[model samples]
Target: MIAKELHDKTPDQLRDELVNLKKEAFNLRFQQATGQLENPARLRTVKRDVARVKTVLNQKAAAAATDA
Candidate 1:
């Protein structure tokens, strides 16, 4: 997912996305370890997506803090 898309989502939604991405990352790692991974690049993409989601979430939290 792109940062732009992540920015539009609420914090709860971002948290859910984060959880799913982390799960996918774990599965990808398992596949890699078992030599069953078909797309190695996917793991990298998922990792980056996770980072983007976390970044967006943090930005939202900070904005809320400042507003309050």
Candidate 2:
């Protein structure tokens, strides 16, 4: 997912997306270990997307904290 799109999402939505991505990442790892992975590149993409979501979440949190 793109950072811009992610940034537009509310924190709750981002958390949900993060959970789903982590589940996919875990499944991808399992597939890789069992030699069932079709696209190895997806692992990297998912990892980055996860990081992006995390970064956005942090940014939002920080902004909220400062505003308050």
- Highest lDDT against the true fold, candidate: 2
Candidate 2 lDDT, 1-68, residue by residue in tens: 78999889999999999999999999999999999999999999999999999999999999999999
Which portions of model 1 miss their true places by more than 4 Å? none
Error of 2 at 62 (Å): 0.3
Which lDDT tens digits does candidate 1 get at residues 2-67? 788888888999999999999999999999999999999999999999989988998999999999
lDDT of each: 0.94, 0.97
- Report residue 35 deviation for candidate 2 (angstroms): 0.4
Q: RMSD per prediction, one decimal?
A: 0.5, 0.4
Candidate 2 regions off by >4 Å?
none
Clashes of 2: 0
* Residue pairs that clash (backbone atoms under 3 angstroms), model 1: none
* Model 2 residue 56 lDDT score: 99
Cα RMSD for candidate 2?
Answer: 0.4
Return the TM-score for each candidate structure: 0.97, 0.98
